[model samples]
Target chain A: MNLYELTIGEAHGLLSRKEISAVELTRAVLARITEKDEKIGAYITVTEASALKQAALADERIAGGDMTPLTGIPLAIKDLICTKDIKTTCASAILENFIPPYDAAVMEKLNRAGAVLLGKANMDEFAMGSSTENSGFKITRNPWDPGRVPGGSSGGSAAAVAADLCLGSLGSDTGGSIRQPASHCGVVGMKPTYGRVSRFGLVAFASSLDQIGPLTKTVSDCALMMNAISGYDNRDSTSVPREVPDYTQSLTQGLKEVTIGIPRQYFETDGLDPSVFLAVQKAVKTLQDRGATLVDVSLPHTSYAVAVYYIVAPAEASSNLARYDGVKYGARDKTQSSLLGMYRQTRSKGFGKEVQRRIILGTYALSSGYYEAYYNKASQVRTLIMEDFNTAFKTCDVLLSPVTPSPAFKFGEKREDPLALYLSDIYTISANLAGIPGMSVPCGFSQEGLPVGLQILGPHFNETMLLKVAYNFEQATDFHKAKPVF
Target chain B: MKITREEVIHVARLARLELDETDIETFSHQIGTILEYFDTLNQVDTQGVKPTSHAIFLTNAFREDEIKPHLDREKAMANAPEKENGYFLVPRVIG
Candidate 1:
């Protein structure tokens, strides 16, 4: 196999045995990025100089026999995460020139693990949209089909992993940013329980909904990344105080006696493409044939998830995004004369149209007269959505569903219709609403040959069970092994 | 509920964003359509259900009143669009 095609686990084995040097691996991946990323547009920045330096240090550590699983592994970071001295644009022109002075808690962990940073991946501007078309820089194409999108917000991260531009990548999920794209790109993408991972320095979109997680070629690599990135951090007030498990150790080869719930509402939802339904159904049957029991479950509130998410996410976003006024950091508008004018012009020129729309929607929702009617009502209904999941989990260990209603769609398909784009996330938004760990694994392909994702969801902080279920499913199929021929 | 063009402009003002007339009209129609879908929430009788700001309940996380080293002055000012004398430059507020 080519060096660029090795998974994190395989590379670790080779690195430990001195069969390949860190610099060699890093160069191979960088060469792949140079060759393919121009057509794919998967990255905003590629740090060739800094990456080689880091690889040299990682090689020194491996030579000293002080290596970790991620040592010398080239990984891409979704541009939202803060990396010290590196430009962390959340795919917005507002922060296009902004470089953070500190590393995010997750970046600190990755740095300590001796991982090599490939560069910043492209994303939806401030993670506001479901597709990377919202990116301020360039649109990322699906490696499988150049005419299609690679999913959103974390589209670049998913596309990078899918195209073998990097071994693994980190992405933040608010709504279905990570999983939806991971599904579209045919890789393993996970979003941990809301507070299971720290959010400090994560360039907040919706403070209550965002969580950083991993996108990798296999479930085991996803688990290895989970072990590295998940833990408690006092820097973030919402990070849960819980025991961090060795997620890779939880990858058992059995699904015996496990009860998997099939949320009936997801299957019956309007606009669910027939091909996606069949693929997900086939995946569930594969699980049942392997000794797991499938139970029909109801999450009646599922229908309201998209509505509640639109209100709640935008409400938080308006407040969180109010910080960018061309004052402290980011690009400033020089033509404005007055203070308020600067704020208006800087934001108007910097933020994209979808971003502007959300800011307005959020502002209206939280405005004086509309607060109780829109924002408050949405939050109250959010509780009902959570309770639905809690009640369903009472009878099943995990819930199985489709990641998105359809396989990857062609670009400009839903670009003009905002509501159509929002409706596509119906299946995956409930997990974020309930603050549960959710993941998307490649299960089957549609008639168009685009990948389909099987979504597995577990209650809060129940990542071990979700990973085990995904790991077992991955072992049963060669779907994860199928790579996009670049 | 239908979002009017005037309301869209008003909300844009509150968000400190300057939208052209074309954008205001487009947003008014789009936001109105989305808010119409959100009206589905009003049907669910959440009479006494408490509003949840977060999925999991967390309280004020306090630590010992401690001080740690913070970002150096140079690094903090590095990304400022306009900076002078180790401080960010903003529009004049008073005559």
Candidate 2:
């Protein structure tokens, strides 16, 4: 196997045995990025020099017998996460030149684990869109088919992992940003329960819904990553003060006692592609054959998830994004004389059309006279949606569904229709709303050869159960083994 | 549910974003469509449902009043568009 194609586990084995040097592995991955990123557009910035330097230090740590599982593992970070001294653009022009003064909480953990940072992966501008097309930088293409989108917000991280540009990558999920793209790119992506991972230094989109997780080549690699990044930090008050179990410990074989809930509403969702439905059904049968019981469940509010998410996410985004007035950091309109003019011009010019739309939508929702009708109304519905999950989880250990309603769509397919794009996240948005852990594991491929992902969702802070189910399915199927022939 | 150009412009102003005539038209139509979709929520009878501002419930996370290491003046000012005397300089707010 090519050095760049090695999973984090495989590379660790090789590195520990001295079969491959850390520099050699990092150089191979960097070379792969240099070769493929131009066509894939998976990165906003490629930190070659810093990566090599980190790799050298990782080698020293390994030589001194002070290595963790991630030691010397080269990975890509979604651009939204802050990395000290590195340009963390969040794929927006406003912060195009903004370099953070401090590392994000997750970055501090990864750095301590001796993980090598390859670069900042591209993402949706402010993580506002379902397609990376909203990026102020570049659109990331699916490695499976260059004509299709890799999926948004975390598209670059998913594409980099799929194309072997990096062994594993970190992607943030606000509304299926990580899982959708991981599904599109044919990789394993997990969005841990909200607050299960710290959000400190994560460029906030919707503060209440956002969670940082991992996109990896395999389920076990995803487990390894979750172990390293999940923890509470006082800096982020929302981060839960709870024990994070070793996620890999849950990767046992059979699903004998596991009961997977199949939400009937999801299968009945309009526009769910037949191919996706078939693939997920086959995966359900595979689990059943593996000694798992399938229960028909109903999350009645599933239909309203897209509606509630649109209102709530945008409302939060508008408030959180108000910080970018170009006074302290990011782009400023020097031509404007008055403070108000500068604020208006800098934001108008810095933000893309989609971002501007969300800001307006959010501001309008929270505006006077409309707050009761829009934001507050949506929040109430959000409660109903959360209750739906709470009711369903009572009958099952985890819920199974399609990560996305369809396989990766071609670019420009739904670019003009914002509502259509929002509906694409229908299957995955409820997990964010309920603050439950959700993951996308490659199940099978469409007739078009695009990958389909089976989504496994568990109750809050129940990542171990989610991993066990996903790990068992991954072992039963070879769909994850099928890589895009880039 | 139909948002007018005037409403879009007003919301844009509230958001501190300056939009062109074309942007106003586009956003008005698009935002109107999205709001129309949001109308679905009104169908659910949420008479007494409490609003969920956060997913996972947690109390206010308070830390002891203690001074810890923080970013120094130089580092904080490094990304500032304009700065002088360790303070970020913005456009004149008053005459």
Candidate 3:
């Protein structure tokens, strides 16, 4: 097998046995990027020079017998995560030249674990869009079908993994960003419960909803990545003070006695592609036949999730994004002589259309007269949505649904219609709204050959249940074994 | 819920964004449609429910008041669009 195609677990075994060095693995990945990235457009920055240097250091660590599971593993980072010396452009022109001086807490942990940095992956500008076509630089194409989007704002991370540019990647999920892309790319994506992973380095979109997780070639690799990143940090105030188990230890063969709930509302979602629905139904039956019990559950407030998310996310985004006033950081409009003019010009020129739209929506929602009518009302509905999930978890250990309503759609298919694009996230958005853990594992492919994702959702901080069920599902299916021929 | 061109311009001003006439017209239509869709939130009865700002309830997370090394001025101003010897340069706020 190609070194570039090895999962984290596979590569770690080889590295620890001295069968291959980190430099060889790093070079193999860099070569793959140099060979194929022009067609994929999965990276904003490749970090070739620094990646080799880090890989050399990882080899030294392995020689000294001080290695972690991620030691010497080359991985791509979603551009939103801050890296000390690398240019972390959140795929926005505003921060095109912005270089962060400090490393995010997650980056610090990865560095300590001796992981090699491949580069910064592309994302939606400021992570406000569902398709990476919103990226200011370039659109990330699905490796499965180059004409379709890989999904965003973590589209690049998923594409890189699917195309074997990197072994595994780190992606942040605000509203189904990671899982959607991983689904589109035929990879495993896990979004841990809010606060389970530190948010210190992740650039904020909606502070209350954002969580950083992993996109990998397999569920076990996802667990290994989680073990390294899931812990408390003083930097993030919301970082939970809980014991992070060795996530890999939860990987077992069977799902005996596991109750997988099928959310009736999710199955009855409007505009759901018939193929996706059929695929998820088959996935549920497969789990049931493999010793799991299926239960019918209902999250009655599912209809209100999209409405609540749009308002609440934008409101928090407006406040979180206010920091980019062309003064403290980011580019400035030199032609404007007045302060307010500079602020206005810099922002208008810096942010993209979707970003501008959300900022305006957020500003209008938080405006003096409309706060109670829009933002406050949305917040109240958000509480009800959380209650619905809490109630459903009582009857089932995890809920099963389709990650996206359809397989990967072709470029420009839904880009023009904003409402149509928002509805694509109908099944996955509720997990984010409720601050629970959710994941996507490849189940089947469409008639057109695009991958379908089966979503597994667990209650807050119950990633173990989600991972166990996903691991069992992955072991039973060969869907994840199928790679996109690049 | 109807976002007019004037309202779009007004909200842009509040958000400190400069917009052209075409952008104003387009945003007026787009924002109006999205908010029209958002009208579904009004259907839910939230009379007695408390607004949740965060998914998980958290209080003031305090830490010991201790001295920690701060970022050096050079690194802090590394990405500033305009920078002086050791500070970020901004438009004059004082007359």
On lDDT, the stronger of 2 and 3 is 2
Return the clash pairs for model 2, or none.
none
Q: DockQ, per-model, please?
A: 0.89, 0.91, 0.83
lDDT of 3 by residue, B27-77 (tens): 888889999998988789999999988887777899999999989878787
Docking tier of model 1: it is high
lDDT of 2 by residue, A311-421 (tens): 889999999999999998999999999999999999999999999999999999999999999999989988999999899989999999999989999989998889899
Pairs that collide in candidate 1 are none
Error of 1 at A100 (Å): 0.8
| Alpha-carbon deviation at A361 in model 1, angstroms | 0.3
The alpha-carbon deviation from the true structure for residue A312 of candidate 3, after best TM-score superposition, in angstroms, is 0.4
Cα lDDT, all candidates: 0.93, 0.93, 0.92
Candidate 3 iRMS, in Å? 1.0
Q: What are the per-residue Cα lDDT tens digits for candidate 1 across A251-351?
A: 87588868999999999989898999999999999988888888889998898899999999998999999999999998899997899999999999999
Query: Better model by lDDT, 1 or 3?
Result: 1
Which candidate, 1 or 3, has the higher DockQ?
Answer: 1
Interface root-mean-square deviation for each candidate?
A: 0.7, 0.7, 1.0
How should the candidates be ordered by lDDT, best one leading?
1, 2, 3
Q: Which 10 successive residues of model 1 chain A have the least lDDT summed?
A: A248-257
Name the weakest run of 10 consecutive residues (lDDT summed) in model 3 chain A.
A248-257
lDDT (C-alpha) at residue A262 in model 2: 94
